[model samples]
Structure formats: structure tokens, C-alpha cells
Target: MHRVIISGIGAEIPEPVITNEELVASFNSWVDTENARRADTGEPLLQKSDSDFIVHASGVKSRHVIEREGILDPTRMSPRIPARPDDALSLEAEFGIASARKALAHAGVDGSDIDLVICSASHHQRPYPAIAIEMQEALGTKGAGFDMGLGCSSAAAALHVAVNLVRAGAHKRVLVSTPEIITGHLNFRDRQTHFIFGDASVAMVVEGLAQGEKRPGRFEVLDTRTWTQMSNNIRTNLGYYTRTAQEDPYMINLEGNLIKQVGNKVFKEVTVAGQKFIVEFLAEHGLTPGGIRRFWLHQANARMNAMILKLSFGHDVDHDRAPMVLE
Candidate 1:
């Protein structure tokens, strides 16, 4: 098997920060001024100690990109002042670029070197060209590319796809990206699924660059396994646009509590499978969990991260580095 190593990385997020105050003001004006005031009824999470164990999480704080302000429904309502040009790419595309640039920068490689570009995202509706083409044009790449879907696992699976392409000789360099802008399709009235997602994207690069390169990096492609159970009939899925919210087309929906109950249960029940995934991932190089240096899991909240870490390594390991408490 050909060896595929991570060589260079880059990322780009939207120019919009949509700070809490701005969001509160914007969201308030959209709804009845009375109901808009409710958006902040729940105390803003930003005020709480960053170290406090998270509870009653809501999706509207921290960081996220907005297409524009003052023009709530740009597609329909033409606000006097328009949105910024960078917002033209839409939130998903914006987030995709965010991590793409970071990953490229990390690998010390420019976009020109990527031979294959893979976008693991779910919020694109343009039909003239695949988002990858626009991404390539954005990065100025002349590479073969495509897009894939796998919900929250899209990021991890994109890595697998990059390694496979390198090992199969289809390409020598690959850049994979995963981004979500679910808030674009959110229905504020649908409290069942609202208030759980933040917009973001990340990019990673794996290449067949010569092994003797200057800086050190990571390698090894184990295996990827997917499982579907009763929850598939109920919980577990992606966040994108909703026809129901067509008037508010850009909003995204995330079934927070539903995901929590189902995900926590899966975290508990999937221990054997999770361990097996670990075992198989290591068997490729005669290694195991102890041999690995990091575990980057995307937990929705601190509570979820704490529970999953306990499952993966008990409650003893340092989790400061884990990607937890997003949203």
C-alpha cells in the first residue's frame, strides 16, 4: 500500500463573526419585537465561566458567520443596505474555506499543490457547478475533485478518502474539507430542533509528498466503519436548508435534545464497536490506542464530551485538547 502522509493544510472561515449582541439585535428585529426580545431570554452563554460544566446549551453564542445583517431575508426582503461580498459564497462555503486555509497553512503547502479536493459538507444548493469547483477556483487549484456526505462523521471520513486516493495512485496530494452552516435552515419556532448548532468548517490535507520534507507530520490510514441502528429512524442526521423555512431559507435545524439522548445512548452502547474501530484502526500498523497521540472528537457540549471521554479513556485523561463543547 502506498503511504499517505499529511503534508500541508490551510483554512478560511466567513468574514462574519455575528457576535452575540449583533445576533440578539438582528434576531429580535426579525421576529415580533416582543418575541425577538426572547432570543436573549436565556442568559447569554458567553457570560458564564468558560470552565463551568456546560448545561442548558443553546446554539446562538460564541462564533458564527451571518450572510448579512439588516437584510434578514435577502432573497425576499431587500433591506436598504446589502450584505458584504464575501457573504456571497453563503455560510457553508464560507466555513469550508475557514478550515481549508488553516489545514493548508498547517501543512506548509499552498492550494496549487493539492491534486484532489474533497468537500464533506451538506449545505450547497447551486447547480451550475459542484461546490468543489468553486472551492478549487477559490484556492486556484487544478485538481481532480468531488464531494461526499456523512453527517458529523464527514470530517473524519474525508480524511479516509484522502488517504485512499493517495494509496490508490489516483492522486499524489489531497485536501479534504467539512463544513456546516445549519443555522441557515433553522426554524426558530421549531424549538424541538432549534438552538443547537453553530456554523463552522475545517480542512485537512494529506499528500504523497517526499518523506524527507523539512517539517514533521502525521500518517497512517486505518479503516472507517459506519453503523446505523434504531436511531436512524429517529435521530442522527445532517443540518441544512428546510423547505418549510423557504421564506427563511438560510436557516438550519439541529435536533439538540434528540441528538443528545440518542447520541449518549450510542456512546454507551457503542463501546464494543467503538473499541473495535480502535482495534482495527491500529491493527494496520501493529499499534493501538496507547500508540496514538490524539483523539479529536466533535462533541456538541461539554457534558457530551465528558461522557464520551469517560467511555473512550475513562474520566482520567486530560480533555483540554479535545474538540468538545461546540454550539
Candidate 2:
């Protein structure tokens, strides 16, 4: 089996920034209007969102978004990104292309050098025509292209696939691009999840190593593994069937279909699961937590990551131990 290494990594972050204070102001305004309507029917008033509470709950102070026009608008609590014509490149593909170009450049290769392209992310804008194919055409790449998703693990899963494909001689060079436009699907009015997501695109170039090849600062792939268990704690019900399954097929129901999660349950369950997975994975390689120099964990909740690392190491972990990029 051939050895594989990550030749390059690139990231493209959205320009529009949304602060917690601004988000809270818009949410509180909507809450006031909603409560006023509920008052007449004797319905319980909705509690106003606080910026301080958001910070205390999640370490995110601000987030980048593709667009800010409708997101900050109290009437519409979602991003308003205009749809492009069919002849034009897709938004996700366009974003991914930028990151891909950077990664290709960093790898000292061109688009023509790539043999495979995998576009993976938490959510895809569409189901057909595959965003990876679009990106491949735009980048002038060859071979096969496809798309896959594993929620928050999409990037890692894509990398794993790329490495294995190279190691197995199925592909020599693979480009894995993750374009996460989460703000577009985020429910900005939900207090528990409003500030949890942002918009960004990242890409990595995985290639088989030649004998005696020396690439400085490259990450060599030693082993890869994936584990999954059924759980509905973190999920989104919005899908193609969402509109069709409704009684009024033409009507849209955004509630209960958008991203909604049991935050507390996810925190507790994932913490234990993460710790166990880390320990077992390291043990399988005849290593321990102390043997690793750094940990670049999933940037979900700051507290949850800290707790997981603490449980794994049997002590409190500082920022240097497990760095975060939630904000």
C-alpha cells in the first residue's frame, strides 16, 4: 500500500460579520412582537435573548455569514442569498473553488494535477448535479467527482476517504473541499442554536508520496477510522421530502424541520463519546493522550470540548492543549 500525505490546506471565510449584540437585538425585537401577539390569546410570552447569555452558553462572540441583509432583519431571521441562474456556477462551488485554488497553489500543483474531487459538508444546497462535479469543471480537473456528507464530521470523513483512496492506489491526488454555508440554514430565532454556526469553506489536497520525497510541513496519514451510532440529539429535518410529506404539499413548514437540537443532551452524550473514542483510538496505536502534542477537535461548544479533553487527560486542559476556532 502506498503512503499518503496532506499536501496543502486552504480556507475561505465569509466577509460579513455578525456580533452577538446585534443578533440579540434583532431576536429581542422579534420576541417582543411575538409576545405582544401572544398576550391577547393568554399564551406564554417568549423570553428575550441576551447577548451575555449567548456568550456564557457558547464561546462564540461573533460569526461570519455569506449575507447579513435578511439575517439581521427581525421579520426574516435567515440569510437572504440570491439564487444564481443555472448557467452560472453555484454559490457553494464558487466558494469551494476559491479555497481549492489556494490549496492547489499551496501544493505547487495545478487543477489539472488533481485526479479526484470530493465536495463534502454539513449541508448541501441541492441534491442533484453534485457540487463536486461543478467544482471539477470550474477548476479544469479530471477523473471522478462526487459529494458526501456526515454532518459536522464531513470534512474529516472526506479527508479519510481521500487518504484511503490514495493509499489503495484508486487515486493518486484528491481534492477534498468542504463548503459550509451553515448560516443560510441556521434558525437565527432559536435561542439555543442561533449563535452556533458560521459560514466558511476549506480545502485540502491529499496525494500519494513518492520514494524519498520531502515536503516540509506536510501531514503524513498514518491511519484513519470512523465510528457512528444512531442518535437524534443533533439533527435537521429539512429535506426534499419535507415539502412533499406535508398535508398541504405546496405549503412550507419551517418549524420543527430546520435545525433543532437537544443541546444539553448533545453536550453530555458527546462529551462521554468523544473521550471514549479518543482514548480507544490512541490505545489501539500503542499511544496515550500525553503522547500527542496537540489536539484540533471539532469546534462546536467550547465547554463540551474542554470537558471531553479533561476527561481524556484526567485534568483540566488549557487553550494550548486544545485550540478552538468557534468565533
Candidate 3:
């Protein structure tokens, strides 16, 4: 089996940063007005949120959103990205192509060298045309392309698959791009998770290293493990066929289509599950937690990562040990 190495990496972040202060102010203003309206109708008032509370809860001080003006608007707290023509590249594909181009350049390889293109992300722009295929066409690559979704772990899962394909000699080079347009699915009116997600695309070039290849500076994929369990703690209730009888069958609304998460349940369950997986994964490979130099964990929450590391390592790890990028 050939060894797989990560030759290069690149990222594409949308412009216009939305600070937590700005979001909280707009959200609270909307909440106050909504509450006043509800009071007139004898309905329960909506709760107000604070910036400090948001930061402490999720450790997200700000985020990069695709539509800055519309999301921050008190009236319409949603992204207003216009739809593109069928022939034009979708927004997700545009970002994916930008990141993939940078990754290919960094790898010192052209698009022709990529044997496969994998578009793994939290969500896709459309259902008919696979984004991976569109990316392949845009890059002028002559290989197969596909899409995969694993929620928040989509990129890691895709990396695992790319590594295996390269090791098995199925492909000499693979381009994995994760373009997360998460804000499009978020209900900004909902205070629980409005401040969680951001917009960005990350790309990586994975290539097979033949015997005696002297790539001294490249990083090798030693091992990877993934596990899945049935749970509804985090989910979105939306699909092409799902619809209310009273509403149009094809019309998608934000009511049930947006992301819904049980914060407490997810925090507890994922902390335990993540720690167990890391411990077992390292142990299986004859490695220890302390021996690992750096831990680039998922950019979720600061407190959650801290707790998971503490439980797994039997000690408290500092920021240097586990760096966070959610902010």
C-alpha cells in the first residue's frame, strides 16, 4: 500500500466580519419589539440575549457571513444571496474552486494532476447537480467527482476516505473541498443558535507518496477512525418530500428547516464520546495523549474542547495544547 501525505492546504473565508456585539444588539432589538407585540396579544414574551452570554456559551466572538447587510438587519435576519443561473457556478462551488486552486498551487501541482474531486460539506447548494462534479468541471480535471455529508465532521470524514483511496492505489492525487455555507440554513431569529455558524471553504490536496520519496516537510496520515451513533440531539427537520399539508409541498420555510440543537444534551454526549474515541484511537496506535504535540480540535466551543481534553488526558490542557478557531 502506498503512503498518503497531505501535500497542501488552503482556505477561503468570505469578507465582512459580523461581531457578536453587532449581532446581539440587532437580535435583542428584534426580541424586544417581538415581545411587546406578544404582550399585546397575551402571549409569552421572547427572551433577550447578551453578548457576554453568547461568548461564554459558544466562545464565538464573531463570524464571517456571506451576506453581512441582510443578516444584521433587524427585520430580515437571513442571508440574501441571490440565486445564480443554471449555467453559472453556484456560490458554494465558487468558494470551493477558489480554495481548491490555492491548494493545488500550494501543492506545486496543476488541476490535471488531481485524480478525484470530493465535495464534502455540511450542506449543498442544490440536489440535482453535485457540487463535486461542478468543481471538477471548473478545475478542468479529468477524474470522477462526488459529494458527501457528515454534518460537522464532514471534512474529517472526507479526508479519511481520500487517504484510503490514495493508499489503495485507486488514485494518485485527490482534492477535498468543504464549502460550508452554514448561515443559509440558520434561523437568525432563533437566539439559541443564531451566533454559531460562519461561512468558509477549506481545501486539502492528498497525494500518494511512493517508496523512497523524500518529502521531508509533508505530513503523513498515520491513521484515522470514525464512529456514528443514532441520536436526535442535533438535527434539522427538512427534506425535499417533507411538508405540511396546509403549505405548498415544494416551498421550504425556516420554521422547521433550520438547524435545531439541544445544547445541554449535545455537550454532554459529545464530550464523553469524543474523549472515548480519542483515547481508544491513540491507544490502538501505540500512542498517548501527552505524547501528541498539538491538537487542532473542531472549532466549536472553547469550554467544550477544554472539558473534553481534561477528561481524555486526565489533566487540564492550556490554549497552546488545544488551539481554538471558532472566534
* Predicted model with the maximum lDDT: 2
**lDDT score of model 2?**
0.91
Candidate 1 lDDT: 0.56
Going through the candidates in the order shown, the clash numbers are 30, 0, 0
- Best-to-worst lDDT order: 2, 3, 1
lDDT for model 3, on a 0 to 1 scale? 0.89
lDDT of 1 at 305: 46
Evaluate residue 86 in candidate 2 and report its C-alpha lDDT on the 0 to 100 scale. 95
lDDT of 3 by residue, 1-327 (tens): 998899989999889799999999889989988998999999988888888988888899999988888898899988899988899999999999999999999899988999899999999988768999999999988789999999999999999999999999999899999999999988888888888898999999999888888687789998778899878988887766566643776665657667988888989998999999998999998888999999988897877898899998899998899888875
lDDT (tens digit, per residue) of candidate 2 on 1-327: 888899998999889999989999999998889889999999988888887787777788898889987999999988888889999999999999989999999898999999999999999989879999999999999998999999999999999999999999999899999999998888887888888888999999999998788778999988998998888998899988898888998898998888888888998898999999999999999999999989999886788888899999999988787898875
| Model 1 C-alpha RMSD to native | 7.3
User: What is the C-alpha lDDT profile of model 1 across 1-327, one tens digit per residue?
Assistant: 566677655545556554444444444344444354556696332221221212343223545544544323412211222344543664455567778888887887788987778888645544335667668778877767677866566777778777887877888888888777655544432323333454667787887644555435565454444553444422533433343555555655444422323334555555545555656756777875556677765544455445445555544446554544454
Query: Sort by TM-score, best first: what order?
Result: 2, 3, 1
Give candidate 3 misplaced runs (Cα > 4 Å). 244-246
What C-alpha lDDT do the candidate models reach, one value each? 0.56, 0.91, 0.89
Count of clashes in candidate 1: 30
Measured by TM-score, how close is model 1 to the native structure? 0.65
Q: Model 1, residue 229: what's the lDDT? A: 43
Off by over 4 Å in 2: none
lDDT of 1 at 126: 48
